[model samples]
Target: MDRSAPPSPVSSYSARRGLFPENEPFAHGWLSTEGPHEIYYEECGAPSGKPCVILHGGPGGAINPTMRRFFDPAKWRMALFDQRGCGRSRPNASLEDNTTWTLIEDIERLRVHLGVEKWTVFGGSWGSTLALAYAIKHPDRVEALVLRGVFLLTEPELKWFYQGGAAMLFPDAWERFCAPIPPEERGDMMGAYHRRLTGADRKVQAEAAAAWSQWEGDTISIRGPEARPAKFNEIDFAVAFARIECHFFMNGGFFPEENWILNNIEAIRRIPGWIVQGRFDVVTPLASAWALKSAWPEAQFDIVWDAGHASTEPGIVDALVRATDEALRL
Candidate 1:
């Protein structure tokens, strides 16, 4: 289905590298975590500074250059990595050993590889999911958290994304996303989309990809009249994106049948955290952020009044930048 949400009324994507000058010529490389996969990452800011890892969204989305702006070069060392089988990483969406547990383990391995005893974790959307899972598994290794668009991977959240919960706001996009297939296929939405999106017919793939991208874009971002269609590498982006999300969806996103966050609330409650949510976020509702606040009453939750899901949204980006700066102070 079209999972792309419209960009917020916010003006444009965040400027890259302009925020930090001294950290010129950022470094990029791969880290072999001694696991089944190699992770692609970029390092900016000060090497000897406090360590802060940034996780990008999408089970398959690559880390953009703007992500580095969240950190203060003089105060914190910033690390951004495309998760396994994702951007920069080899074997994109290979599905050999990619799962939530594998990703959690990957973070621990990355920590040891980076030679850090403890470091702060910063992530948004699916990245937030990985951060929480990693922290819960190894609480002592996490100094703090800066979570945005917090997603708990609960059944309800999954239903909202795949089913019709958010359709009220973007029914046109949703309808287009599901149009490539027959009515019978709607029940197994992702499965049906996967078949046509990966089918031999170029026409079918193009239609499915466009529809899916448009649907997601409409809800997440506010499109302008002059906005053109997004052009993606079908094999590299569309196929991999579909497989990874489906892999997680069919398996219920690797979360326990019950809400693990609620089940283990007491443990994560003590961890220092800042929850950032967009008041108008259709991808992940504000309710999830409030629910998280209820579970960890001490953690500060910031609501960006006019923003949606995209971190690049002006208000949300500002909050994330502030969160990064806050982490550096500690």
Candidate 2:
């Protein structure tokens, strides 16, 4: 496949493709990790077909049904799982032993346990970060990569979203994000939220969780509040999402040094890859995607003009599906 040429814009067509019809996993179960955590996983699509794994965003984001629609069930054996402390995973939201390195090991464990030798890796947002980490660590096991809303968890990226770069665009939502923290502590928003989120006071934790999670929900879509996922409002989901995300962000994604993903890009440079990014994604933004592309030019890069950070956006859905379909030929 000639990845030299960028994919034509999806909006250029009369009709843009949407997600595949909703489908359930044919097989689902929990895998016990070396530690106390037990990860939840499900498999859908053809039992004997091209293998692929879908990594959901949020470092804390759990798997959702809509994620299954990105691939052709008849042609792709898709695997989706909850990373460490989110979704159906056991000990809900417990940050015990959770780190970027542990999650990468868990992915390897899942691949071996499922009997998949080499499979395409599909991820977005934080998921995209994990996918890159995993591919770099175990390049031989990855056949290809499909990434969206690229987030490297770099200091600047974190400062932009949590500190105030995104705030410049959504000041209203940013005001609410800052409301939980006092003016004095506003200087370090993530640190302030982390202290409250991980603090002993349940009331404080819940309050910070709601505010932190809602902030992401409010700005995730180009369509605004109406398009934000309703799940973000639930306290249980917010706790896991905010806590884990905060934990990772506060700790610099547990990376040895900053810019780890791009520094290690050469490890997977030969692997087939696709990067789908939203032109107006305030959450992950376009700069990270452009940076990744600059480092790994072999991967196909597609920008969805009408989309934002969320995968459900029509343009993103079309571009992702098209990327996955093209991976089938590999």
Candidate 3:
């Protein structure tokens, strides 16, 4: 027990942020979406325990195994899945039938497929948008929500990141992101990027995909220069991510109406939710999360001061774990 001596292995614990240890999904499989598209999904923790779901970011981001760790295996039955056109889903990066509503339908379909009665929904970044959309659409099926780095997918929020607002914080990264498109096309970054990302030229698509993905990686986490950005180099993964993200953002998330989340808040007001946001999150910004909290004041909100947009941040990881635990209602 010497104060200065290294702690023994039995007593030692991970200095990593978050209360939960990294765990693996015990089972996984593919859920076929409408058409040839198949969505990849996994299950972890006790089969008869409280239900929970992980809504991954990127609109096209894959579900990381580490995301399964947020819940205690003994206390929860958790589900994590990749949206259409991303992750282990087949037909890598195909944009056919991929849209915001398509994803919401996919979620409900996954739940029915899993036989989950109701679940505490967990999502961050674009995931949050999907989570909210799903909750509003089917309030009876949602037990609760744990949202991080919230993105409402509003037109103004789109402008903040793609247009000029976030550029104020990371001018260098923004410069690189904007460098690919001509000035005339700069007025619509999403439209401009979509052209190259979906264009016939593989070389051009790959280039735009990397640049688009890198800009997000570079600015998302406030980690030091030594910390590596999330890997987005795989051409297929990059292209799908960039293209789907641009596709959603350009079409304003394909919402039936503007400010859709707020407009439909009453439907989800009774469904409890907790927001964990980074104060310095340039990717989605804290303001949007705050606005969501304001609209849905029934939800719990936390602002992590030292974190950025990535849920990988220590503060966010811890907050998300706590929220997941809280959702159990025990």
Give the candidate number with the greatest TM-score.
Answer: 2
Per-residue lDDT for 1-330 in model 3, tens only?
012233357743355346466667778899986687998999988888898888989877888767887788888988988898888897788888888888889889989999988888989899999999999998999999989999998888888888888888888889999888899999888888888988899999988998888888777888943343455767777888888888788777898888988888999988888989888888888889889888888898888777888777777787788778788873
Compose the digit string of candidate 2's lDDT tens values, residues 181-211.
9999999999999999899999999999999
Regions of candidate 3 where Cα sits further than 4 Å from its true position: 1-19, 224-229
Give TM-scores for every candidate, taking all chains together and pairing residue i with residue i: 0.86, 0.96, 0.92
Give the per-residue lDDT digits (tens) of candidate 1, residues 73-101.
77788877878888769876566778899
**lDDT at position 324, candidate 2:** 90
Model 3, residue 191: C-alpha shift (Å): 1.4
Query: Per TM-score, what order, best first?
Result: 2, 3, 1
**lDDT of model 2, residue 271:** 99
- All candidates: CA RMSD in angstroms? 5.5, 2.6, 5.5
